[model samples]
Target: MNVTQFIVDTYGAGTPLVSTAKRYRPSSTATKKGYILIFAHGTGFHKEHWEPIIERLYAHGGPVVEAWAIDAQTHGAAATLNRDAIDEPGFTYSSYHFAEACANLCKTHLNGTRHPIVLVGHSAGAASAALVPSFYGQSRTPPFSALILVEPAIWPGSMIGMADSLAYKLACVAIPRRRTTWRSRDAVRKDLGRRAPWGTWDKRILDLYVEHGFEEDKEGVSLRCNPVHETQPFINQINAVYPVAELDKLRKKVPVHLVYGERNDLFTREKQESLLRGRRFASVIRIPGAGHLVVQEAPDAVGDVLLSILGGLENQRYVEREYVL
Candidate 1:
């Protein structure tokens, strides 16, 4: 699929609160009936990761939805709010900050037309989307009309207060020590193919990840999102509250769709019911044989799910589709 790459300024030149995005829009006639879909990737990933899924969605028969995938602050080409401290170690990565930045970008750039805005986010971005509703409360017209969260970063209620736990502390330490450079992009791909999450990713998606996730350096290739920035959300609990209330607030006003991979270890069936059971406009589904990174594992399947959801939204039916894994 063809795309336009651009940067949206959030806080002017001095601040590092800019966002980089990839956008795809169908021909004018086909786009008249669709909502604007904004995709926000997880921590450490670039907007390019959303391309495969976008391609699959367009390939399948459906309403021609316009889509944009954004690289969050501290990731991809987006500049940091504090340019002077780009290499700082103790910086915090708050989901609230990401949500506000996303809202700013949508309001400033994507809201030019009359289409309803739908925010789709994965992992950390999913959590950020969850927070967006709270930030935009009921007083004013919400910038986004719907939300599609994939394996969000929300932990179980029991673990909400365990931000200082040993496992999280260990992740805080281990994540920062991750390798940031490689001899080349091919070398990075080969190395990541041998790693756990990356090993599970589809080759094309992984290639796209490397293509946008890294930048050439004097020595070799280094991660655009530094380890410090990528690891902040894991260790910092300053913004790690449960999002049940936030989701509740969003469900009342707009459709809230939750998609989880069946093999995902993060979300349990009980948790799904607890969060989405009988809400006025909420639904949940599981993708068979998939995991937390379902977008990378099965872009076509993810795309099919998204198209189905979009169809439902357009028809005001909230229809459900079945995937065979």
Candidate 2:
């Protein structure tokens, strides 16, 4: 299958935002599937980071699938769409805004595809999925059939006013200090290989970051998602908080699955239990020996888990297999 890249313009809260997507169409008509899978990336990462997982999904096919991975506004190829937001340090994005863009993208581009969508997201994108169906208001039916969230960056209502606390303050100071330009891709990779989080990432994922996360410039390659846009979201996490009732409504509309890394500190047992308290169709599974970047560290493993879910969806059965790396 060939992967094609494209872009679509959409309005989010009346503001113009652009989203980029990569499509992998099925090779044979014999295995055509019922749903289109859409993948959304996390903060500071481009849609290309999903390539490894996409490749695995195709190789372990249960049905012919048309899959897409989208880049959020201010990330990847969509970064140039809003120069003002790219330049302004105070400009921040919200989950509702991102959700709106995703919805509009579907209406504009995937309208006649005749496929139920299986929404998959990681980190911040996962949070956006939680708010997509009810973006504008309450709706009886959603566009998606199921949702797979990986380590979503959801915060409690209590953290709404804590944006200016020590953590956000430190992120504000640290993100901008990151080096923006590199002499070459290898140079960028070498530099990143020495950093804590980046160094911990799988080599292929780190390569994708160096490949799609930067833009060519006369001086060298510069980060596409600059520090200003990246740090702004970190400090503005309060804007991402939504009523639990809204999420509950969405979960009732479709099957929602949560995938977390065993070593990830974000999803404590109490937090997971709280999230699954009243949601009957919601389930949780952990990937052992992984952290918040589990998808990156073990795309093949994650891809296997996703395929099982998709198979279940295709056969009208629910499979919540525990995946251990």
Candidate 3:
């Protein structure tokens, strides 16, 4: 697959800029009309984190014309680009910023593109994906043909104060005091490999994180995303439940699919079920032996699920065409 990197200035005057990586088969044409995937990563993760799953998708010969992974303003290369703004004393980040960025890409970079687009996201990225259609309002057509959310972080507004939840602890405790700098990438890798979350991640995903999730300086390599920025989205009380409302509005317009890890590490069963209440979805799947970080723990499984969803979509389209005929 050929990979190209670029940056997109988000919509709205003061919004932060974002970075993206576009991947496609070398033999594929720009004009090919197939599924175009736009991915958004969870808090504290970079765009390249999805590469392992994407490679599997291509290897399976799915009908993917191309895939684009986005870096939220505070994460990945976008963090480096927007350092000054992000470092501002009162600066804060939220899923809404990511939604604006994705929406902007659809309006500018993907405008008039013929391919059906699938918006895929994990955790906070899933919240942003759910909110993307809201930016277009009811009058305009949303860019996404479907959404595939993996371990979505969205919850009801009333659940924000659930301090016992792993998500809250991760945001308010673990992340705030976590080590962010190391003498070398090797050291960083070794350290994280022995830790709870990273230790559980697939080795390939961890390797990718070691390679692309940090920035090097004379002192050492530090996480590209600042801990403060990362924690903000998790604690953004008002924004935490914002996507649930968006999801309700979106369910009628596009097929919404949910992918979850069997373990209830970050979000409990009740939280996951809350997303399904009174809403219709195309499909819901859970990968065993994984937790909230399913993308990292089971990239191959994630890839398989994505391919299956795409296959179903393709078949549905064929059936619709036949019915029309």
Candidate 4:
């Protein structure tokens, strides 16, 4: 796959700029009917984390033209770019910022594209993905033809009390207190390899995180995304619940699919059901031996599921055309 890196200056007066990478097979023969995929990563993760699954998607030979991944202003390469602004005291980042970046990419870089655009996001990234369409306003047509939310972290307004949940505590307390600086990449890799979540991650994803999720300096290497910045979205909780309502609105316009790991660690059964209440989805799938971090834990399974979803969409389009004829 050929890769290209670029930055998109988000719209609005004070929105932070976001970094993006595009990947495509050099020999791809896909035309307008092929899908153009846009991806958003979870909090504390970088865009490169999705590369493994993307590689699998390419190998599956789905109707894919190209794939694009965005780094939230306070995560990955974007975090390095916005260090000054984000370092400011009281600076807070929200899912809205990520959503604005996705909306900006579609309005600018992908403007007037003919291919069907599919937006895929995992965990907190799914919140941002769900809110992307709202940024276009009611006057404009949303760029996405479909959405695939992998273990979406979105919750209804009724679940505002989730701040007291264990997941919230882990995000706000444990993450900030976790080790950040390491003596060397080898040391970091060893430490993470023995940890709970990291140890559970696919080796390829773990390798990607080690490569792209940190930066080297005089004091050794540290996480590219400051732990404080990573906890901001969890602390703010302002935009977290908004995605639920947005999903309700968007489902009528585009097919919205949900993918869950068989294990329900972060989001409990009741919490997951909250997202389904009074809303219709195109499909719901579950992958065994994975949790909320399904993208990192089971990339191959994710790729297989995505290919099936894409094939279904293609068939649906064909049937619709035939009906029109």
Number of the predicted model whose TM-score against the real structure is largest = 4
Error of 3 at 44 (Å): 0.6
Position 287, candidate 3: lDDT: 92
lDDT (tens digit, per residue) of candidate 2 on 198-259: 89788889999998899888988999987766765566755446635567777776788888
Model 4: residues >4 Å from true position, as ranges? 11-16, 26-32, 163-168, 318-325
User: How do the candidates rank by TM-score, highest first?
Assistant: 4, 3, 2, 1
Judged by lDDT against the true structure, how good is candidate 4?
Answer: 0.82
TM-score of 1: 0.85
Per-residue lDDT of model 4, residues 1-325, tens digit only: 7788878887442645656655555356654457888999999998998898888888778788788898988889888888888788877667888888887777767776667788999988999999988877576556677999998888777776553557666767788787889988888899999988899999999999999899998888889999897776667666678798788878998899999999878777677877888788999999998988899999999999999999999888822111000
Displacement of residue 35 (Cα, Å) in model 3 is 0.3
Candidate 1, residues 115-217, lDDT tens digits: the string is 6778899988888878766655468545566799987776546555443444446667888999989989999998999997789898888998788788888
Candidate 3: tens digits of C-alpha lDDT, residues 1-325: 6888777887442644655555544354543546888899999998888988888988878878788888888888888988888888877666888888888777767776667888999988999888888887577656677899999888787677663375656557778777889999999999999988899999999998999889998879999988888887666766769898888877887789999999887777887787677777989999989898999999999999999999999878821111000
- Ten-residue region with minimum lDDT total, candidate 2: 316-325
Please give the lDDT score at residue 293 for candidate 2. 74
- What's the best-to-worst order under lDDT? 4, 3, 2, 1
Clashes of each: 2, 1, 0, 0
lDDT of each: 0.72, 0.73, 0.81, 0.82
If scored against the real structure, what TM-score would every candidate get?
0.85, 0.86, 0.93, 0.93
Higher-lDDT candidate of 2 and 4: 4
C-alpha lDDT (0 to 100) for residue 259 of candidate 2: 87
